[model samples]
Target: MLNRKIATSTAAVALLLTWSAGLTPAHAAPSSPAPTAAGWLARQLVDGERLETVVDQVPYPDQGATADAVLAFAAAGVAQDNATKATDWLARPQTLAAYLGDGTTESYAGAHAKLALVAQVQGRDPRSFGGVDLISRLTALQAPSGRFSDKSAYGDYSNGITQSLAVIALERHGTAPEAAVDYLVDAACQDGGFPLYLEQTPCASDADTTGYAAQALLASGRQAEAARALEWLEGVQGPGGGFRGSGPTPQENANSTGLAAQALRVGGRTAAADKAVAFLKSLQVGCGDAARAGAIAYDATGFDQGNATRATTQGITGIVGVGLLELSAHGEATAPASDCPITTTTTTTTTTAVPATTTTAGTSTSSEPAAAAPVTSNGTRQLARTGFEPGPALALGVLLIATGVLALLLARPRRAER
Candidate 1:
């Protein structure tokens, strides 16, 4: 009888273990880093339409930032709907008026070039964007020297960013002008990298300018020059694989690192590219916070909401190993959570049995069982992030006295202005 009782207890325990296994919830699988970041970024958009920049307690539509967001969406191969909405918002007449000017007194070479690329990526006709001829307008701004200049009284702020953009846009449209291609090639610094400001003395090379210039060169069939530029980039890459802009005291940041990584990958530097992706992933918010999980921080200092928009937007390209020229949207619309480190917890019931692993937003390693967090039906954690999204794509103070001032400032645009 004693033996029989012992056997019965063993059988009960086995049955309980089997039953518990069946009851264990299937944890959500974490998404790849690219989609993970892209998903979080898609949520950051205000009303899923645009990103707004505030100046002097006022909000204006940030077309530059919005354009970057579209490119980010396309590069990640996710968030096609959001990309479409953003492009549509950009194509709005009022929005175009604010960004590209009314064809007279305020046409920006950089704005036209950047928006033309954005329109092309969205499968929209750049020729007829917002009832404006982007191609002709952009070409019209090209000087005799082949540099695309801002044809406005405010002065020319066109730099390598705008020039590279113009070349790529024109190349994609059909054929890049010979003069434009030559101008881009001639702008290469002595170090084989390109300068952000072509007019800057000594022709100091920076990662941001070199990255775009390399891509533009490749697009224009200048393989030899592009190779030289990529070589220079390989030299400037930080030991940890991050890159900083060209400056007296450059500190590694996501924006420059992101663009450099894109160029390296396109230049066929696989080993270097992998290192860059790893470096970018290191900056990603892996676990702990549900809402900020997939967001990539600006640097080692950690994630800051104020700077996260540009950081994540540019950073995802490197994470996914795509360049601006090769970006497109063709994946599922659903945003996936990042694959965070697994957290194991034990639950005590009638028997001291360990529960199956479950998916939790953010990384945690607490031994104590965590209470269940609310999840949507499809399993995405609801975002707690809110308010106007900032982008570093455009910077302009609002003033009616000089509406054209926006275009003038746009001539010399920054990649991070929003």
Candidate 2:
């Protein structure tokens, strides 16, 4: 993402071509001053200034959620109080292993890797973060086959997420093991994509797993393997330019597309990368509610009520051409404005109300639905849902004004739920 460091003309030319690929749609759409998309993520802190998930009215600190909060802040260049608070919480000496202590259920190994990456991105030392030498801790967990795992006893913990994060985290400190690299490189399925669980050969390919594994393979200097995985991603790209999630349902969401976009760009598939980036940009909330601007949603649903915070955080990195691992490094992502993608597909949150129905009392119906009026493609109104209502249209004519900060508040996924 730090373009100023790349000296080659080819790299510079590529940056030029994709810098503004899909940002215009967001920029052109106008709404009142509101909370930036990144702002939505900052508000999720519960107790101890650390991230927490509610479980039966009890609050438990979550490493993954906290790590996500840090990445969200870093991606947006936000250096505000909340970001500092989260960083400070992470830096506490006693919190090191405790943050990743959910060995019974969570991937404790993966937590170490994610926090190590987070520390590095924040310009801290991964070796001694929270008074814990995570690099060493993670290294000790690597199996003879180079795959990383805590081998948690309660539930499945080892997966592409665990391996990929470990690979990337170790890479930042120049401690990545070659054997570990091979573990991911050789885990490729027959279809060229990677699966979350390496249960057997010829496994099904998944977007999230494949995306992370492709990144892991690329970081490990196994470009051939990474290329094959990337090729599989291209094969599954949706018509709207986003990549689909794994499994039979195969829905494309911000998380899947963001990872694939990063992998594609890193793999040297410029056009494909641009398209994926565009797809993500198209989902960004230009501005509608006061606090949802600059946030990316899961898909065309623009700020999914369940994914607004996590999705927007991850999506910002993709739009900047940096994968989650790369986000761990300290630098600004440089890009041209023209390279940003504009969204062509708009997901409607509401449809127009029927004109009116005669009341059972033999009088004209007087009440309109409590929901906001339905918006049209141009973000204008063919007619307000009712004759008395005014449309909520941004100057860009955003197809609808469904995005708002409240959506983010309601969308935060609690760690307890997992």
Candidate 3:
């Protein structure tokens, strides 16, 4: 009897572990990395519409991050419904006024170009979005040197990024001028990479700026400049396949790696792109936590909730293997499961049958043996079977194992007493 009890209990423990291993998170119904990252990003939006930033204890919509989310969504080709909501929010009058400026006192070159790109991605009219001709406004910021300057009372604050965005937006609109393309070409450093702030002394090349600049140059048909920038990016790639922003002591980060990955892929550097993707994947938070699953961490430290939005938004583009120039939304809504290692669990059942004996009227009589209960390790029960897929299944699995061990210990103690 004791042996039979032990066998049954051991089988139960194995069943628990197998169930836990097979348990799939409700939201993560098996998907690729791109869709999974995109889905996580979609959930980060405020009310499924926009991303927000808190300032002075007040929350305000962050248009730039929101635009980035849209771009990420397009790049991954998923979450089109949420992407539509975000794009709608960007097209709102007040949102446009705040982000793109009032058009009378302050108009930002980057903002204008970025939103124009967003509009184009969503198949909306950048010419008349939010009652503003985004293309015209963006073009109006261009200077004689072909650099797109910001029209603001505070300062010009434009740089390589602004020029890149302006060129991409104009190129996509089929109105990219030769001067604009030439200006971006001339901004390249001697090392064949672009700087974050053009005309800055020493012209230090930046990973992020070079990433965007390469894509822009490619879009404008500046193949030579684009090739040089791609080569520079490859040369500067870290040993672990990551990239760093421009700084004396720059650390490899997911944001920079993501941007660089997109550039390398689009620039036809297949080997470099593959390595970049691997680096980005290393920074992704995996299956341990369902809520943060598929989220790309900023760096090696870990998944940071505070900076996750930006990191994830930018990181997703690279993971999806696409740049902004080719981003589009045409994927399904299925959230992806992280590529977690699977541990195959096996269970063995030992059935000990003892013949049934009956005692009646002070006389003992032997009867036929009882049938063995069915024991199958491959039970269909799982966390998903329980209609929940949070963290409970893992905890419960641990508890079950502990209980089984405790049972074994208690059984041994009782046998000794006997």
Cα-based TM-score, every candidate: 0.75, 0.66, 0.75
lDDT to native, each model: 0.74, 0.61, 0.76
Q: Across residues 121-191, which tens digit of lDDT does each residue of candidate 1 receive?
A: 88889999989899999999999999998867778889998999999899889988999999999999899
* Model 2 spans > 4 angstroms off: 1-35, 46-60, 93-98, 102-107, 247-249, 324-418
Model 3: residue 122 alpha-carbon error in angstroms:
0.6
TM-score of 1: 0.75
Query: Taking the tens digit of each residue's C-alpha lDDT, what string does model 3 give over 58-173?
Result: 88889999999988888887788888899999999999999988886899999999999999998899999978999988888888888898889999888998999889889888
Clashes of each: 14, 20, 0
Off by over 4 Å in 3: 1-31, 55-57, 333-346, 351-418
Q: Comparing 1 and 3 by lDDT, which wins?
A: 3
If the candidates were sorted by their lDDT against the true structure, best first, what order would they fall in? 3, 1, 2
The global Cα lDDT (0 to 1) of model 1 is: 0.74
lDDT of 2 at 343: 32
* Candidate 2 Cα RMSD after full superposition onto the native fold (Å): 20.3
